[model samples]
Target: MQRLFNDCIYRIKALGPEDSTKLFLSRAFGSTNGSCPMELEDAMKKVLKKCGGLPLAIVSIGSLLASYNSPESKHMWERVFKSIGSEMESHPTLEGMRQIVIISYDHLPHHLKACMMYLSIFPEDYVIVKERLLMRWIAEGLVAEKRGLTSMEVAEAYFNELVSRSMIDRAADIVNYYDGREETCRVHDMMLEVMVAKSLEANFISLIGGQYEVMPYDRVRRLSIHGGVEASKQSSFKKTAAGRGRRKNINAMNVEHVRSLSVFELEGHKLLNQLGEFTLLRVLDLEDCKVIGKKHMAHVCRMYLLRFLNLRGTTITVLPRELGDLEHLQALDVRLTFLEGLPETVTALENLECLQYSNKKDYISDGPSKTA
Candidate 1:
């Protein structure tokens, strides 16, 4: 792989400052008509110098500048140049790149902002499976139902828009799955840092990690355990209630406010039972968790508000019949588990949109009779 990367580098030619500047301006303003605008020439030169002919830097900066959409005006271009002056002058590091990327995020349509911010739930460099992410989005009610289009289709369009804008990239290793051609997306690390910051600010997704204290605003709406690290994140959260000189009442933490929770490789049975308190929960994803038995997931069915439930790659051999109690459930993923058969009540999920199990086969039903 290293040799291939090195060989690929050897085959490429570096873009000169002139071409680099032209590319950035053209991408930003849509078209420069084969010439740079005299009114904005000085500001463009400054931006190009900071970008240093680096493709990623250029794209990031171009996206920021494009937000202005009036590159023909001297003041508009100068304002953008001034906004990035501090970071650009400092150095071409990830922090500098982050400033540029953030501008693009801020300019996204209001509806897409939450969708983009949700990407922070996954750890850095995490390969996000397309079908799983979209299904999760649909379950969260992030994609608004539109006329003549299913929420799944709208979610796919959102994913593609992010890809087109270079916010996320398609993962190289593709796996064939039941949904579609196996594809995944990944966000850059620098941008991931900005996303984490934004998510925390909006209180969109509360991320628990090492030595963190629960503030008044910490009441989780959507929670992601193990932000990047695996074992440490869980342990940190577990100790949060005990560590700080803060209140010890677990009830004070308001677990009920959490609408979505994703845990990876969970080995604690205690935590699994605690999920029962989150009655308002909509999405509970325990993929790859090491839950001991069906008892661990007993509370899940009682979550009447639940729209999505994922128990993939767990040790469970049987699903509780109470799962039918999730009347509002839309997506249920029990893939890669030892469970042999689904409960009869599973057909009771009239609103269920996607059901993924062990085999690479899709089971669609209009009602129980059609399935029969």
Candidate 2:
């Protein structure tokens, strides 16, 4: 916290308050060439010259002052009425961009506002993966579901809209499909941080729990539970996984509220034996989890509608013969797992096109490696 504060202070010092203020005005008031008519541009540029080139500093100051009485707007406008020329320069850090985002974010619809801020979980400069982010959003009940589309598909559409408006950035990650659909994506480093921080206050994001929550599991589509032991809180026991994977809240059966489950991140969590029956589950991520016994595999196989399944970095020796049952699966990220062979059942997936990890040591298949 101190480091971040110090960095901000240092950057501020570098800009020097007066010069930074001049920059701020240009970003907020001076018209960018394409944005406004020449008549308006000339006047706006003078206003911006008052604050040098710092965009964010100007946004904060402007937004704060913009909301006051009409008299205040008049006062600021009068100052602009007198000004000079285009003096605002590009900002040195992302703080200014973030401030502009915050200003715009404050104007979004209440729900969309929450959704936008929740994306800050990944590392800065991280290219956002669409499937993974969408799942978290669905699991949180942030979007309404449609009848024909699977929840994962529904989640992805929302992500597209956010990116289209520049609310988020798209990654250059590409997975050229046999059908030629450009289904790959990613987010910028600084923007990712902005989204994660927003998640804290909005509860807009949830992580697939791992041993050391370092990098978020940005792989699944609709719902990811932190698959760790903290998941089974025996000490403060209240509900089990049997009934809709939710609690009755004995006091008010009418107003049922369920605790959001997180995917356990511990290595042993990979060994799925008896998964808690969660009919309400939207995204299930087993990407870096280590232990996966036969029982867990069977339960996972039967999860008919699972949209995203990640077996990446797991120590599974091979896929169970029952691995091909997920007809509704969209993405199967099996990268870096210890599996030697794939069950022919995998061929049953008409929709499975994104299989990764073909260069490992083993293969339990009669045919050539599909991953290669």
Best by lDDT: 1
lDDT, candidate 1, 163-235, per-residue tens? 7566777776453333335567788866788888888888898754322335444577987755223344446
Error of 2 at 47 (Å): 8.5
Q: TM-score winner among the candidates?
A: 1
**TM-score for candidate 2:** 0.50
lDDT (CA) for every model shown?
0.69, 0.48
The 10 consecutive residues of candidate 1 with the worst lDDT sum are 363-372
